[model samples]
Target: MSYERHFEYPLSASSRLTGSLALGDLETGQRCYREGRLSVDGGRSLPISLTHSPATERLMYGGEVECIEHLRTSLREMGVELPGSGGRWLPGPLLLGSERTRVTQAGVLDCMRSPAFEEALANRQEGEVVVLPVLREGMKYGLQEAVCDVLGAHCDEVVVDAHHVPDESVPYLGRRMELSVFKDADLTLAQREKVKVAILGDSVASGTVIIGLIEVIKQRFPNVERIELVAPLAAVYGLARIAAFGNEAVPLRAHVFESLLNALPPEYYFSPFFPEEEMHMAKRAYSNYRDWWGVDKAGKPIAETACAGYGWSEAFFNPRKQIAMIDEQLRERHGMGLAEVLGRY
Candidate 1:
């Protein structure tokens, strides 16, 4: 028997960035730019020269893969090993970029160039899942006709098209149109009153937003017990560090080196590259470090609580490990008289 599965997901911010570039769609590109989702600065022009050719298309995809592969290989060669190896674990860049490349190579590009695909894409409502099946594998074993069975276990609610719908017993996943799902969901009065925030802003405006949020929260809810601030890919190192030290005077800069090692795996703690294994590793390392350092008399890990509300649970996620790895690689490359490797575009 043969089985077919379609892995559908919303177009991520990065994917939209690449897609806009490949399609030479200025409107999409400008939207991404205004939203601060495009990482590479095109600056008054699209970074890529718009050319319609197989080679040019391949190069566009391959360029991103090459850059990520270089970083991964360089970091590995410098002895910055990832945990639980299946060779080297896939970093976010490689995973995301390669998937997009595969999808494009699988004929999504042709669809994208068509007016039908463009119209469908443009008119797609928010929260709509875009199905992009890049590969189809053959197997003798038969399977049920359900999304969960085809895709394996997933935590999020899975919905299928009418054709793929299993049976009347299993209801279709309902779409929630509200901006805040929490508002529609059942919550206790106490839970409703709690202060939880997810902040989104550009570098220049983020600090102002944070300050403004805190002031508003304090004024609005005087008795709020816990305040949680979540900022994705924002610089929280200073905030994390301050939380770590608390009332105690910050230790010497030398301590930062050790702290940096503990924070390596989850690069999101420091940089905005989507986290992979690094986060789990960082959490484990911090737990071990806390154990070794011993807890305070309150039976909690001293300084560990500082990063409680920040992404990491222990210390500020700094780029110490990344910096250290790059420095080591550069030194090794230079000593080998292969310094030119660093300039390999």
Candidate 2:
């Protein structure tokens, strides 16, 4: 039972997280990852690869990859030449793939050929910024890479756009991974009763991680009920671009906060940030903050306390401090392996 049929496939699938979303085959499994896009419905047909027998023929019929190539041809035809020594491509919309096409690495390459896209790129003067939304670990990584290459070709000094990383990785940097949940464990009674949990960061990655944890916890603690996400929902990548390009005059942070208030249901209220809220509420509930390395064992309070002093008083003047703070926070809070902390609760 999918919540919404059309919006379901390219989403944070529950079955895959639980290891039940399989067709029980090997070649099909490879196809799921290797093939750019099997269907527009976000790789729903990918399970075929998991279930395919040894004799399963590779049906490379005019699938997602083909559509991506078409998008690339369209971009080139529209005159948005991605500048480079030779021609390489941006990965497609791996995260945003719908039923119409599995927007893979090649598909994003073709998007460059689109007339609307070219028009978007053409206006970039020396001091302008281009905001690109891409997947961290999947095919969309190519899109980020390609966009950077083109920006370098066109701009006088192209500064790469990066978002907040919970790893030792820098801010504005992008990480990559396949679409799958990395952990599965039951939650304790306290965790299940967490009526208010804050999802601090951004990205579809955050959504997947948060939802996966919720599902696991719910399964593990069936007796308890009512788990909630506390933070206002704002895409970190989008916020980063608005911050960088819109500059101080626009008050982007306040704007995003307002949008978040609007998007969410009326019951939720804005807190300082999820990390801060975790520090305040960790005593009452067993909360967690997740990142690329993996989920941590410490309570949300410990994580927030560790990151409290990060960032400079004046970020514009002390950008290096900002980066170092980011580095420190990631190193300190992330990198912990899963633990049996649930038993303590």
Candidate 3:
């Protein structure tokens, strides 16, 4: 049975963090990474996204090649472009899409129409930092690629094949995080010598994986002084969980795309809700769900089916299973296939 869920993430006023974050703030440069506006109801505080970008607004609409192009082109104009060598796109959000869109190799390498070898001369930052990407999610691998693309390949990198499974038996916020995977991941002495900052790039929902990675970093890299979280989409619960670890000694900072998401209820991992304006389901795919699922109090079309992050962080890792999961949910909810739902029309 589908459990009733009301989207609400209430955090205590004193400890809740908020504010705008720049892309460069993902390093130790910005001291005040924890700053943003808060949404309050009565005496309790609510989780909110640090929004102020046209890219985030763009995401709420079309989920096509053009949408990706516009974002990349805009970023290039802002001096951040990534053109894969030999006509290849490093696996990022484009290829590692959600259940809404399947994976594809075709990229925006030709979109903005940059001069030949121009993208090769992309932004290069001389930094003593390591970009640590959690393995399995090909989407986040893009972040790892991006750091090297912009900061030069000489930037240190450590891939941690760690995993975190939530214990559903306890409260969602206070649930005991069980580390299912923690190997002896490390950086060489040369990689760690001057590397004081660690930039971790990944999509955070419940923030369990990050919590585990932090433990690994503390245990392995004691020389590291600062931690920066670069998650494009994250839940409020996850950010708050990581925020608790921030301090003057080893300050922790976070950088989200445009907004913070509600961690839902019970199991908070499936809360990267797709905005009604952003979701672009084909008529053959989910037009019926628009009617059956209807709208939510927020006017969201089919609140249940609108979550863009349906298959967690690895939608592209196992495409077959991702597609199957989407079909299964649609069938289980509407009690029929899209054809039957379309027959009425």
Candidate 4:
């Protein structure tokens, strides 16, 4: 029996990759590549013609072609864009750059869109300083790291928000932190005992970095009991809770952190931007989770009355336990796993 198949964007444009067309029938258990206009199949010579679009990267069948359902299914499963029932093609998301760009392509495209930024990048030279005035707070460090990696040139200095803070402040902060971590002389007894990890960024990609760090910590320091992760924006609340409830209490345990874990909508897990719609959805989800948990705005677990007290930060310190708790809550409420969620990022 003969089967019909529709292909979209079937041709390869770049010489770096080779594309092939496979044809076959199931019963004969034979397959062949279309090498010429005429091919001998099942003791009969058949004429075939194939056309391709260089601009659109789409393919069109010009003559009668025979295939099998298995081949069509396999192509579809391999992420080949194929035409649907009405002969309409379904396309995937448009990626920004070539294979060489890979992870840094997004940063490159973002830079290119702004003419001023592109000009600045083009004019930059080794051992020179670059100042970024209006870059987002969370994206500054990551963007600098990515640009430096992609360009293969290092700037003597990169400054962020020079108007508000001194030029030395940002670099000093990073260097001080690095020295405190790597230099043995700078570590105090208490600091050595407590491992403090901070993921200070606003994007979901930052959150995935947090997840990967937690996994690495679990692998490298299995016995190190005290591990703290500081979320910069939420640190004030965490510290308040610690101060109010004392050292033994777990911070953001009842509602705040729980709400964060539960409020994350499925789509926002891997999305680059956190827009207003997602923010509203997250607020609603957080409220729902708080209501379900009988927690009030003040971090109190009260079913009827609103209680006033701060939450602690012990949860941030115990990463393994916190990850386990998050996984449990997500599985119980959303039927999702932490690994699955992080995989999207």
Stretches off by above 4 angstroms in model 3 are 1-61, 65-127, 138-140, 166-186, 245-249, 274-300, 303-305, 331-345
Question: What lDDT score goes with residue 95 in model 1?
Answer: 23
How far out, in Å, is residue 330 in model 3? 3.4
RMSD of each: 24.3, 23.7, 12.4, 26.7
Between candidates 1 and 3, which one is better according to TM-score? Answer: 3
TM-score of each: 0.20, 0.20, 0.56, 0.21
Least well predicted 10-residue stretch by lDDT in candidate 1: 134-143
- In candidate 2, position 3 carries an lDDT of 11
Q: Estimate, for each residue in 111-163, the C-alpha lDDT of model 4 and write its tens digit.
A: 22232223334544443322121113223224445346644564222221111
Please give, for residues 126-169, the per-residue lDDT of candidate 2 as tens digits: 32332222222222224444445554532111112223323324
TM-score of structure candidate 1? 0.20
Q: Give the poorly placed runs of model 1, Cα more than 4 Å off.
A: 1-88, 95-208, 230-345
Q: Show model 2 residue runs off by greater than 4 Å.
A: 1-103, 130-135, 138-140, 148-345
lDDT tens digits, residues 144-257, model 3? 455554445556567656555546554334444454443334556555555666767666776667765776666556777667665556665565555443233455555544
Candidate 1, 56-154: lDDT as tens digits: 223111222333454455445645533332233222112222333342232222212333223323432322211211001101001111112322322
lDDT of 3 at 142: 48
**Among all candidates shown, the one with the greatest lDDT:** 3
